[model samples]
Target chain A: MERLMKIDRRLLYLISVALVAVTIFMPLGLPVKVSPLAVQTYDAIQNLPDNSVVLIAPMYDPGAAGELNPMLKAMLYQCMERGYKIILGNTNWTLGVAIAHDMITPIAAEFNYVYGTDYIEFGSKPGGSVWMQSAQTDLAGAAIVDFNNDPIGQFPLIQAVPRLTQEYIAAVLVLDCGTPGAVEWLQIITQGTSIKLIVGEIQMSVPDSMTYVQSGQYNGMIAGSRGGAEYEQLVGRPGAALKSQDTMSVIALMVALFIVLGNIGYVTRKR
Target chain B: MMWLLAQEQAPVPTLGIFSAGSVIDFAIVLGLGVIIWVMVARARTGRKIPEIKKIAGLEAVDEAIGRATEMGRPVVFIPGILSVDNPQTLAAFGMVSHIARQCARYDTRFLALNCDPLPYAVIEEITRQAYLEEGRPDAFNPDDIRFLSAEQFAFTGAVIGIFERERPAANIMIGAFYAEAMMLAETGSFQGMIQIGGTAMTAQLPFFVAACDYSLIGEEIYAASAYLSKEPVMYGTVVAQDWLKIVLALIIVVGAVLATVSPDSTVLRDILGGY
Candidate 1:
């Protein structure tokens, strides 16, 4: 009982690593059920007026790539399928835009979306929330150049939406991880505007983001990896998030078992 | 009639200083400043003010350091992973000073680990000052104040490696933390070290609360410096911030109720939105 109570953490780590490896190689294909939130998120994007422009900000870096990357890809696919004019970018997190740019290239090509007309990548801007404030007032002045460093004034999509406002933008989908992210967008551009704010959060930030969703400040939210898988299912395109559901479930169950074992050992020993 | 009238008179937003919408934000900040000034005047005159409530996590700092001293093991302090500009990192400075002073008095090994280079420079000097103030300048080892890494995981990896090697008796983590909170807290727990963690980061709070012996949540971290030092002026500043929170909370509740009762009303929304 004492041994169980104080089980070597290294042994537990080894077991967890091995389990993760095994599950990845041979997935259980655990079914991912689409939740109401996922449905609402899908509807929020799908129900945007035909050919409306939307900006999707991937506000995270490589540390968060495992969870947020799939959310970004799924959202991009949905927007492209609906023939919405997509504006992709972020601020402060430079790598996020670069990572997202690579993901969108092949998908945009698949949808026959033109580079400057149908979609545009602003890459990663500087100044975090300050950049958001600038973009809200004057999109072209704030961005100045596209992902390729080409002059944005020459682009038709940039000319169509002069600023980030309800008059031009239909929705703002944010793959949020930390500060100067979804909250900044909500505070700066989207709140009290007709332009809907939808966010995709990493598991760590889901609790904090939920308040906005509950308060109706955020129109929709894709919760986490579980939410990501469910969203992928809704989009009818299964990706990394969908495939990783089995590993997540197994890990969760393993953790729960460990907790139970430790508690039982402690309780019995107390007697 | 109102809806039709609004559509016809769709107001063009003005680009100006002191716009009607921004007044509320400005007013609140100005109010906080006024409150702070008043409190400071009162504190200087030895006027009565509400006592800062005891924070158990902060109160445990001295005991945790003493345990390390008695056990002849190092005390590890990680002042989060952010630069000095962050409010949380600034809040951590006083607590680190108190810890370093206590360690200097007890002649215990003190390790001040940093993730950001800017804070590393600041914290190193702060630790040195603490030792100097304790009249133990010779005991202060410059090597103990190490800048681990600027990268998040790299810093975390380095801290864990240190924990394994040094086997510190106490771990004090305060300031802004992200994903590394759990990794560090759990490692400390397994080592059976007395752990105290504080951060305003909502996402990382649960990990600290669940794993650490003592956890400071949200504003408690902001109040730590004032409470630990019991400096009246600092207390006044923290109290002013608290008053502002209360005022903001009231506004939020009233706004929520107004919006709920009358869905069509944008009076409060427009003002608060700063549009």
Candidate 2:
């Protein structure tokens, strides 16, 4: 017990790293349990009217990509399967454009989704809430060019959905990390309207977002990485998040073991 | 049919300048402004005001500075990673002015780290003015005020490096903060610095409480300047804010009761909703 108490911190760190690395390479078929919130989120997207247009706003940078990216991919898969016309974009987070475009382009091709009529990528625009408000009135004016910097007027999708209104777009799925995110979408675009707002939030911000869900201000939410894994399963396209579950479980157990060992060592030393 | 035809034929009256939906909101704002003005006037006329409750976090500012002075080490102040537009940032400016004055008076080195260029300029000016006012104009160092980075984690990394190298005796963080709050607070704690943190960001408050020696919770950061300055006029504004809070609490209670009694009643809802 005395020896255990004196175990080097570096050794513990190495063990944790090794476990994570092993899980990354080796297969561990861990079953992921879906939460009710994820179910609601899946249903919300699944229930959208066919051929309706939906806006996917990736409202975070690389800092939050680990959690939000999986959610975005899962949502895209579901939305494409439903044959919903998609508009990919955000305001103020330029880095999200590349992240989202990389995932969207390939998945879209798999579905044989057309570039202009079936889907469009507006990339990232400047101005936060101000851009959201302008898009509500004049989306083309707000976003003059697509991801390729081509005139937005050339895209049939842009012409089809001239403004972010209930008559045009059915729902806005926002992957939020910070300010001018889902909250701004709710306040500026969808409040007091029929347009639905769904969100994917980081784990740290899940509690803050619950009020919006409870109040029916947000139609649904993918809560976190756990939520992302569950959603991927629901969408019938399990990916990275599902594989991460095995690593997370092992890490959780390791942490608990360390806590117990430390406590035991302390107690024995006192005696 | 004839009445409907006549109504259609008649000219519709235009709405007044202030929209009907915003009348209640306008009235509430106007009322609060008037109350603040009245209190300020009374205070200026030498009327005694109620004593403010002590804020332990702010009260320790002097002790933190004195410790730094005694140890012959510098004091660090991070106004947060935001521009000057945020109200929290503006509030931080007020506290920074006070802290700079104290540091200048004590002949202690003060370092202000910034993430935004706009606030960086303003903070430099504030620090200079404070030192000039304290008759220590020569003590103000331009190099001490730095604009680290615009990116969040990048700024955090730079600050961490600064902590390791400078090894300041006190770390004062007051303003809006986000994910980087924990990293900075924990680093300061590791360095054995007396850390005082204040922010209106509710999510980051828990991290500050766990790491810092003293922390100002939500709304307390706003009151810090008035408490430190002891300006009667500022006290009046604080008193007015307290009174408004009381009024808001009453309104919430009444609204809840009304909502329970009559589910169909949209009176309180409409009035509070302001549209």
* lDDT (CA) per prediction: 0.88, 0.87
Q: Candidate 1 docking category? A: acceptable
How do the residues B66-107 of candidate 1 rate in per-residue lDDT, one tens digit apiece? 899999999999999988878999888868888899999999
Question: Residue A133 of candidate 1: its Cα lDDT?
Answer: 87
Candidate 2 chain B, run of 10 with poorest lDDT = B1-10
Model 2 Cα displacement at A268 (Å)?
12
Tell me model 1's lDDT, rounded to 2 decimals. 0.88
DockQ of each two-chain model: 0.33, 0.16
Off by over 4 Å in 1: A1-3, A14-26, B1-16, B136-143, B241-275
Candidate 1 structure, TM-score to reference: 0.88
Residue A31 of candidate 1: its Cα lDDT? 81
Candidate 2: count the clashes: 0
Give the distance in Å from residue A37's predicted Cα in candidate 2 to where it truly belongs: 1.5
User: What DockQ does candidate 1 have relative to the true complex?
Assistant: 0.33
